[model samples]
Target: MKMKVVCVGHRMPDWVDAGVDEFVRRMPRDLPLQIVEVKAEPRTQGKPVDALLDAERQRIEAAIPARARIVALDERGDDLSTVALAARLRRWRAEGDDVVLLIGGPDGLSPTLKSRAHELIRLSSLTLPHALARLLLAEALYRAFTVESNHPYHRE
Candidate 1:
């Protein structure tokens, strides 16, 4: 069965493309990957960061597919080890559902989106730049898929 990964993120600089490309190339050819880019509004010099974050939340929500299984990435979310993530991916695959992973803007995901997620995952307890977070998620997903297939890429 083909698994679909729909990742939502704000606009990023060119540097992020390299890492995103590298990890994406490592994913199995059979798994479909789609990137939904949401444009971030330009921040005024002295505007509170929260305002920007709220705008981001709206953008992220708008990009999500109506029927996809939502997975929000938040610092306060469940912290799962690699093995656990693999198991979750296997379960999702067996259920034959398309998974949509959300990456919020600088402030974070809105309460509504967080509450709507089928699963909320924390990539790291430590805060990371949105661009880097995207790369990490892509790589982790590739690794989890490998583990589920019992590929040598993931050695126990």
Candidate 2:
């Protein structure tokens, strides 16, 4: 199954792009990974936080493929080890539907979106910058892939 990271932001830094590209490039053709960038709603003084999040949510929803399994990344979600993530990846591959991993904008994802996800997971307990989170997600996914393949990229 193909995997897509539907991130609610554009114009990631050069370093992040390079890092994500490397991981994406390393993925096997049978289980390819793609990044779908959504324009982040412009935060303004007058616009409420909920409005911003809702706008981003709409964009994220539009990017998702029909029947895709949604996985929202949130601070409050389950903290998965690499092996656990590998198991989830293996399960997704078996299910044979595209998986959309959502990374919300600055203020985090809306409650509605998170509630609807098939699963919610966090890369770390500490809050990370969006760019760093993207990079980390890419690398983690790559490591998980390796673990599944017995490639020695991931270690205990």
Candidate 3:
């Protein structure tokens, strides 16, 4: 099954794209990894944060593939080790459905969206910039795959 990172941001810096591309290139054909960037709602002086998040939530929901397992990335979510992630990845593949990992915008994901996720996970406890988080998630996924495949790219 394929995996997609549905992030609510666009026009990331060149460095972020280059970093993510490196991991994407290494992903196996059987379990391809792709990134889906949704436009972030513009923040205005009078607009409430909730309104902006709601707009992003709609875009995120629309970007998700039908019947796909949803995983929301949140700072408060479970933090899995690389090995644990590999096992989780294996389980996801066995389930025979595409998986989508949701990364929220600057303000974060709405409670409603997070509640709908099949799993909630975090890359770190510290709040990371969205661009950096994107790169980290891409590399972590690549490392998890390597661990699963017993490749030298990952080590205990």
Candidate 4:
């Protein structure tokens, strides 16, 4: 069974595009991967940051599939090792669950969206730029799949 990765984020730089393209190209053909990016709202003068985050959250929620397992990329989320992520991916595949990885905008995901996620994953303890986070996540997903299939791409 193929699992889908839905990444929701705002405007991304050219570097992000390049990184995503490279990772997607290197991914195994057997694994069906889809990336969904939600446009983030522009912050206006005097406009609260929370409002912008809320808008992005709405967009993300609307795009997510009803049956998919939602996982939010958040700083306060659980930190898992690469091998553990691979194991989780394998289990999800066996259980026929499509994975949806959510990437929030600058201010991060809204409380509602975060609560709705089946799991919240923190990529690192240090805060990372949203654009960089997306690329890193794509690579991590690729690595997880490679590990699951015992591919040489993932060392240790």
Candidate 5:
């Protein structure tokens, strides 16, 4: 089963791109990881925030695979240990379904999207910028993979 990180924004800075690429390169081929950057909705003062979120929802939902297990990234979500993340990843892989991790934009995920997620996870308690969030997610997923395979990247 492949893992896909579905993000709202595209056109990351060079540094961010390099950082994400670095961790992604370390991911093993057995459970290949890929990134799908959906076009984020434009923020306009004229339109309600809900409207923008709805647009994002449509785009995100469209990108998701039918059987993919949705994992939403939220600040208020459960914070898991590296080992726990490894366990979840291993379990998802064993289920033989694609795992799709969702990353919302600056305004965050809408209630509709949140409600549809199979799980929600918070990478850090502190607020992080979108660019850093993607980098951290890439690193964490890579770490989870390493932990699952006993690669020594995560040490208790």
Candidate 6:
């Protein structure tokens, strides 16, 4: 059995892979995390924000695995602690369902996209840069795995 985590991020830099990889390497083979980048819609002059978001949303939807549960990361989403996330991960594992975590670009995900989310989560109350958000999310997933596996990497 394989556990897959697909992150549909908008425009993460090449260096972002390094940070994400660091945590991923710490995880066991039973859980494999993968980040897939979707092309971020360009912000052209005079173009409406809605259009950009819509385009991005389409790209994101296209990238998602049809059977996977969708988890949207948004400012207004529910905040979870490390332990809570671990429990959530445990549930997902027990259910034998893969998950796709969506991270929108500057304009953010469209309302239509958000409405389809199985879980809406917030990493923090403060607005985070796209780069930092990638790193944080990657690490959080690793921490969640550690918590579930009784690994020493995470502490209460």
Per residue, candidate 4 scores C-alpha lDDT tens digits across 1-156 of: 455555555457988888887888887776766778888778789888888878888788787876888888889898989999898888878878777888887788888888998999999998898888888888998899889989898896
lDDT of each: 0.76, 0.94, 0.94, 0.81, 0.91, 0.81
> Model 1: which ten-residue window has the lowest total lDDT?
1-10
Q: Across residues 45-113, which tens digit of lDDT does each residue of candidate 1 receive?
A: 997777777777777777666677888888888899899999988887777767888887656776777
What clash count goes with each model?
0, 0, 0, 0, 0, 0
Residue 45's lDDT in candidate 4: 92
Q: After TM-score superposition, what is the CA distance of residue 124 in candidate 5 from its true location, in Å?
A: 0.7
lDDT of 2 by residue, 15-133 (tens): 99999999999999999999999999998889999999999999999998999999999998999999999999999999999999999999999889999899999999898999999
Candidate 3's displacement at residue 100, Å, is 0.1
Kindly list the per-residue Cα lDDT of model 6 for residues 54-116, writing each as its tens digit: 988888888787688888889999899999999989988888877888888887788988999
Model 1 clash pairs are none
TM-score of each: 0.84, 0.98, 0.98, 0.90, 0.96, 0.91
Q: What tens digits encode model 5's per-residue C-alpha lDDT throughout 80-152?
A: 9889999999899889989999999878988999999999999999999999999999999999988988897
Worst ten-residue run, lDDT, model 5?
24-33
Supply candidate 3's per-residue lDDT for 112: 88
Instruction: Output the better candidate (3/4) by TM-score.
Output: 3
Instruction: Give candidate 1's TM-score.
Output: 0.84
**Judged by TM-score relative to the true structure, which candidate is superior, 1 or 5?**
5
Model 3 C-alpha lDDT per residue in residues 10-100, reported as the tens digit of each score: 9999999999999999999999999999999998899999999999999999989899999999988999999999999999999999999
Cα shift from native, residue 82, model 4 (Å): 0.9
